[model samples]
Target: MLFLFFCPGSFGADTDEVFVMEGDSVSLTCLKKNQQDRIKWYYNDIRIAQMNGDPSKTCTDVQCNEGTERFRDRLKLDHLTGSLTITNIRDTDAGEYKLLITRGNSDSEKIFSVSVHDKVFVMEGDSVSLTGLKKNQQDRIKWYYNDIRIAQMNGDPSKTCTDVQCNEGTERFRDRLKLDHLTGSLTITNIRDTDAGEYKLLITRGNSDSEKIFSVSVTGVPAAEQDEVKRKTVKEGESVTLDLDVKRNPNDVMTWHFNDILIAEITEDQSQICTDFQCENGEERFRDRLELDHQTGSLTIMNTRNTDSGEYKLKINSISRRRRRSVSSEKRFDVTVTASGLSSGAVAGIVVVLLVSALTAVGVGVIYHRHRSPRKAVEEKQRASVESPNKEKEIFLQTQIEIT
Candidate 1:
């Protein structure tokens, strides 16, 4: 977060430009000094703060304007110097501010123009547009990559040009650039590794010009080299290793970046090795879970989580002793981490099989009992007929009694 201050002589209506990030503080100073001078600040033509010669009549922030809460309590005014400080600024704060100084019967105004910059991240083959313009704007817009003009649009007739069209015979971004004629926004399609760099958008409207910068980072390798990237799939809580598969040199410096963020690094001769926060703060996602092979520079991730699924890129820079140049190479790995349990479909299939097996067993037992009962009753009748006359008579009487 950088704060830029440009103070012009406070007599005429000169404009000063300031650039800052969101959530940053900016001070718009009124350089004119007079004991009896009164100062008032206006944002987009709305009064936001004021300082009077009478100490009891001074007001700042919400006290200045009760009808609007845009500034809230984030505004501060210096009673002595008449400088206005805005704390915790937001995107809406990027606009024009006016400071009026009154001395006796004369009044002078100073203008402050503020702009906020942003960062953008994308994967290879994706499209992203840099935006900072209003609809139907008539300003002349120019887009530059690393300070080289890449695209532009003119207000008159809404003419637009890109890449080789913008600069003669330059085909670096021939078919990948798109410029919006309406809003003057620049879009890059089928983005590549060579397209990852700082982009500046300069808007020229009349005599006042405002610039916005965007830091673009592409995650994966180029489309032509996409087949070379290694892909791995692992279950949760499992460990996966991404092997460099190349012999390590004593003068080689290896670095590993996850989603374009540095997470592990090893210096020449393996003298210094760091992982996660040891390499960069606020990178605790892989804390205590990353390991690097000292000999081959391979990376091993332990206890992997679903959040760890992304692109991991390795860059190796080898310093040549005889040759005064360094050789560099990069390798990418796409990892997919899945949950460590059976899928719902698989579990349902197993349950259905168990239920079918139980039903089949019950049907077989019932059929077997029905077939054996008739044969057993016939065998009992034959034994009774073969008995003696007296025993037969007794059996006949017992059967008659059971019948009755």
Candidate 2:
């Protein structure tokens, strides 16, 4: 970096901008038509250090010995004039540094100051989540991706800005990620492993900055499989299907077992035997009596009898190795064989006894009513006489004779 130092009284220069870098070596050159070589360097308005005055004796001795030990050997000077070179600058060097030159009663001086800056990235999640941001709303913090500004700090709810293509479109987020500008927190639901990457954050308050970084994580749930067993109590020779309702991935192969025995390998298709039952033991009593309901995953028992009562178990197998077999609950169906014609006879006997008792109660009510009504019979005779048409005509004739 090049730096030129001149005084306000000097006629040889324009452009008052002075560039100073912290912790870096800097040289300020003052060009002159001729040189008397009276040079001095000052910090702020105070005279802190100066070079050994000489005209042609090689380089002058550095005067950094006048300041603190931190600036030792960090300062150098040319033998010509008031040009000052500061090497290995520090924060203490941020104050104004001035150089004054006098060559034949002509004088010049230049003063300037400097500051050093550093960038710090602070990110919270594997994905984009702005959690625990101090003054997230009005703070003028610039956002960057690979050091490129996509948007500026504007604390308005109507302002909506996000990556449309981050991790293959925002559609995958689907209510999973909640971006709240008011709180400056990005919450992600059902986060998967693919959402891990590098992120950067740059906070600025008139060039004063600080940052934080954090990692987000997710947990996994174990794989599960289930079996379904159904049982029914059917009358002898009654056809009833026991359905198995199962919820599992297609990678699992569902199976069934009846009466503690597997299904035998058979060539016939149209039988009560379920197709999915694999027979390993011969104890299966309903060998051919059990049939598979192909449409629904159920075992149909055709002509079920009293002998088919027992505990039944349903087994499920997984075609994929990643899944494990889980059996359904044990189902018990008690079969009681009703004697031939016994139920019908009992029903018929109940009907007959009910009808006879009803008729006897009604007859007794009629007889009792007649015996309890002697006064009713006399009232009936009087009512019959008064209501006769002949009696009415005689009464009307009497009334006519009286009126005449």
Clashing pairs in 2: 7-109, 23-89, 262-279, 263-278, 263-279, 272-290, 272-291, 273-290, 273-291
lDDT of 1 at 366: 87
Residue 119 alpha-carbon offset, candidate 1, angstroms: 3.6
Each prediction's RMSD to truth:
18.8, 30.7
For residues 1-404, what per-residue lDDT tens digits would candidate 2 score against the true structure? 43445544543434344444434566665554245556666666555455434434323233334444435566666655445677765434545666666667777665555332211122221122433344444554433333333223445534444444232234434555554455433444334554433223345555566432223333332332111222245566666665545444444333454455554222223343334333444454665676754444456667667666665544433232321112111223333433234456688999999999999999999888766555555455456568996765665555455434
Q: What is candidate 2's TM-score against the reference?
A: 0.28
lDDT of 1 by residue, 237-324 (tens): 8899998666788788888999999999987744468888888543888879999888898999998999999999887766555322
Off by over 4 Å in 1: 1-10, 121-127, 133-142, 152-161, 174-185, 189-230, 234-404
**The best candidate in terms of lDDT:** 1
Q: At residue 313, what lDDT does model 1 achieve?
A: 83
Q: What is the lDDT, from 0 to 100, of the residue 179 in candidate 1?
A: 72
Q: Which regions of candidate 2 fall more than 4 Å away from where they truly are?
A: 1-23, 32-35, 52-70, 113-404
